[model samples]
Target: MTRTATSAHPLDVALELEPVGDGTVTGRTTAAYANMVGPFGGITAATMLSAALRHPERLGDPVSLTVNFAGPVADGPFTIDARPTRTNNSTQHWTIEMTQDGVVATTATAVFALRRDSWTSTEVAPPAAPGAESVEPTPGPEFIRWMSNYDMRFVDGGLTDIDGERGDSTTTLWIRDNPARALDFPGLTAMCDSFYPRVFLRRGQMCPAGTVSLTIYFHVDADTLSEQGDDAVLATARAQHFGRSYFDQSAELWGRGGALLATSHQVMYFKV
Candidate 1:
């Protein structure tokens, strides 16, 4: 169902898109999701996926996606072109580009597949954390507007005083929409990018940093997501290596009953 910007939550409004024909959709950036430089990266990625999910020929649920932030997105209107480049008996591939004023700002690719009931097993373990109720919610920094949209209670590696607190770069938290919306693919996609950049924890100070590329794989279907209702999802992330200009982060989201929802990895670049 298409969410009407007029009556839905701010997230729905930020994600709302208008059909402009030929697989293109136009949307505006709202302050609700604004970042220091532009709209938050997670919402940008979610919007791209939403376009393909709404496509007339979209085959099934999104199984995988890769979003590349090519340039900064200014605060205003943007256009996204989501094209299903290929489709098979059970899978479809899509290419999406978000442009502002005819200039490419972000690009993405998505894969959707018809899932079947088959033998499955989870090799990774869920994030070990006390119940969400046991942990105290951390207040988002006032300057970062987008952080206010999520209710986050940290188990460890929470956003710390940037600078001189060099320690482990792993973050475990329970997070959900501030207004408690049902968990879905778009929300799940956005959540995958919700972890603050690991570099901040490593150096103990914020810098000019941003995600360059993010890739996510969804492990559950619609029924499983619906079961989550508006409950917070357990999330954990850790960095592998930090180089001169970039670092790698791997993360996972777990639903109730210790069910894994998705796994994601991102490459972030930073400058001193």
Candidate 2:
């Protein structure tokens, strides 16, 4: 099967991966993924992880995953290399690194669970779900420019400026898997890294200062693309902290009827 790259929004284009000899590969990204932090913000460590894991032969089965952001990223084609840490009948461990313009930009390590094994169940109730039609999507080319990977639709109060005097430090968004290509766990994780700012906009903050790290948890894998055809993926984010030059952020994902889907957290660096 041919692997297709997935985007978080329309402007977020997934650059095709090419071989660079050895155990390395290169991929390009559209400027939309750069965020307001110039051509180097929000490009995330997981983005590199996605590129590294794009090869499914390394993953035993899709399950739970965690990524640690080691550093910053820049615009243009990036390179990634994956090394297997361990592989068992039920799980796989990996160490991945991302390079931009021949410079090491970020590194990550992850644990991916497999589906073909017996395991104990340890599921917990997710956080509260927000109103489906109350939270809205950001509008205009400036905001829209940041979201070019996935297809998005407004459900509430967006399309205005995020100049700090808006609503609260919280907002919800409905995001779907980009149908332009076939997506997998890493792709979804990469997209998860892209969903934010609804909480920041309420504080009238523009441009990301910097992120110390980003983490995501997958409660259920969104394997089938069509599964989300009729269901809307709700993403709710909160600004944990806004300090002199950095911010702590976290977000949760829910299904149409409020099922806990996934959760994400990150430390971001601003442009101020």
Candidate 3:
């Protein structure tokens, strides 16, 4: 069965890619998913990943993904060209480029590998923050349409106090899709970049900031995502360093019972 954008989740609708053959796809940005400066970076990343996922040559599931935002993606039509650069017995590598008006706007690389039963362990401890029900829903910025897509309960480190009162760049929150869509790899990938840019939490004011590059390592497979359903997941994000022009953010997403789903890192460009 073929899936169309209108029949899919809003996120999927926003990232809907039409196969154009020859390892290329076409997509469009929706106003409903627009962010402060442009479309949310997360959605763009997911869209780029979708190109590879939908490709006829794709193998296995995504294990790692890295997206680089080279320029602003204009709303409306865009094109993604994905090619399998390498293919191993149990893994595949892809390079994707997104362009608008014939100019490159984003590029990404992905590694897909088949999962195997093996020894596993989680070393990082989950934060002892209050449960999602204990915290009130945090209001999202009205100008950012994509903000309304998620229900967020902040346990700590939110954008509410952008005046440096908090003094640190740590944000812990519980988040789930607003319409309660089932959890999946594409959704998880979007969530990994969903944390508000660290600048707001650190400086207490909005500044010109955008993600330059983002990387996510998936820890769970398809079965794990299906088990998560539509439940809220705990997300913790913090900045390691904020320099004059750029900063780095590290984050983790954990499912119920402290199962780590993904780990993400990104470098952001900020202007005073």
Winning model by lDDT? 1
Error of 2 at 55 (Å): 3.4
What C-alpha lDDT, on a 0 to 100 scale, does residue 197 get in candidate 1? 89
Better lDDT candidate (2, 3): 3
Q: Which sections of candidate 1 miss by over 4 Å?
A: 1-7, 161-163
| Cα RMSD for predicted model 3 | 3.1
**How many clashes in each structure?**
3, 23, 2
Highest TM-score model number? 1
lDDT tens per residue, model 1, 83-159:
99999999999999999988999999999999999998999898678999888889788878988989999998887
Candidate 2 residue-wise lDDT, 189-260, digit = tens = 655665555444755655544555677676664454325443456666667666677777777766544556
Candidate 3 or 1, higher lDDT = 1
Worst 10 residues of 2 by lDDT: 1-10
